[model samples]
Target: MGELVARSLIALLFVLNGAATARDPEPRRAKAAWFGNPPLLAVRANGAAMVVLGLLLVTGWQRTWVASGLGVLLVLTTIGGHAFWRAADRAERGRELTQLVKNTAVLGGLLLLAMP
Candidate 1:
């Protein structure tokens, strides 16, 4: 029951993320602001990797390794993109901080899913 709920939530998260990546223009701006405007190749690669990871999570394939990898990525992304930049305004900093916490929670969820 708990596992089912967790799996459902993770699936919903990934699906929503994929859909937003496909349809949202704001993400591009946010990515550029946070990630030093990485080259187009890098962006595409990240998106491709995200899609593959999302599929793995959704399908429950190699659950431990996939979730671990995703957790690591989320941590690294938060550190590299959000924590590294201390924004000038409280509002900006708060937004980034919230994202950091959110990513951490996602990491926790992935770790839980990886557990037996």
Candidate 2:
């Protein structure tokens, strides 16, 4: 029961975030401009993958594969979105660093879930 609840909560975060990204790639596009301005299609594709994998995770289907996929997706996202070192201002750097740490924890959780 606890595992199910944890999976559900985590899945919900990814699913909702993915849906939002898929629905509006423009914001992500602008934010990721430093990363060479990934195309809207690419952004949407990533989001779609997240949604599909997150759903699979919560459904207890192919848990290992889904968790691995999500972990990869999260790594990419953290690199592109939470590049704290790139922040020019102190406050901005702090904010980005916080995000990076949060994502790192989430990634750790996903990795644990991936194991048999």
Candidate 3:
């Protein structure tokens, strides 16, 4: 039951993320601080990677390896996108901090799913 719920959540996250990227003309620039200054190709690649990772998680294929990879990618993304910027203002910084926490939680959840 819990596994089912987790898979559903992960799938939902992927769908929403994919939709957001598809809808936005300049996704990289739109969330520049959060996503880093990725080249267009890199941004597209990352999006594609996320979709594949999400699918793997949902399908429970090589569960541990896939989840670990996703966790690593999320960690790197959080550090590169949010931590690196260190917004000047309190409000902006707070938002970034919140995003960091959210990303960390997602990573943790993925790790837990990967565990035996």
Candidate 4:
């Protein structure tokens, strides 16, 4: 079904992104530095949470609760990682803005999934 496919894709996104961050976290660390020097462990924690939440979402167990948790996670990551306004390079700024918008839209989809 289309819903399953959508959920699968979203879950894949979370898993892949999380894996990348967990493995090579310098990029994420740089982004966090834009606000302040956040600890590397925090980035690892995000990665771990994303993978777990994404897997739960794909399984469709307690769908509403999983979706709500993922939605909140996405929003927090967007605020922490995608502060486009703080980007000095124009191209980097543009990229961050795009990612911010994309994540925000995904947050909406997660909220929709959260509905009973």
RMSD after CA superposition, every candidate: 2.9, 1.1, 2.7, 1.3
Q: Point to the candidate with the largest lDDT.
A: 2
Q: What is the Å distance of residue 64 in model 2 from its true position?
A: 0.5
Model 3 lDDT tens row, 1-116: 78978876975676567445544526454465454466665655665677788887888888888788777767765676676356888889888899888887887788788897
User: What is the per-residue lDDT of model 4 for residues 24-101, given as tens digits with 9 covering 90 to 100?
Assistant: 777888777866677898888888788898998898888899889888878877888999998889999999999999
Model 3, residue 23: what's the lDDT? 49
Q: What is the lDDT of residue 56 in candidate 4?
A: 88
The 10-residue segment with the lowest total lDDT in model 2: 28-37
Question: What is the Cα-based TM-score of model 3?
Answer: 0.80
> Which residue segments of model 4 deviate by more than 4 Å?
none
- Give the per-residue lDDT of model 1 (tens digit) for 9-111: 7756655664455455355436555557565555445555566777777677888887776676566557756762567788888888888788888878988
Error of 3 at 51 (Å): 1.1
Q: How many clashes would you count in candidate 3?
A: 0
On lDDT, who's better, 1 or 3?
Answer: 3
Q: Candidate 3: where is the Cα deviation over 4 Å?
A: 22-25, 29-37
Worst 10 residues of 3 by lDDT: 21-30
Instruction: Write the candidate numbers in order of decreasing TM-score.
Output: 2, 4, 3, 1
Q: Tell me the whole-model lDDT of each prediction, alpha carbons only.
A: 0.67, 0.88, 0.71, 0.86
Predict model 3's lDDT versus the native. 0.71
Best by TM-score: 2
> lDDT by residue for model 2 over 53-89, one digit each (tens)?
9998898788888888999998998888878889989
What lDDT is reached at residue 46 by model 4?
82
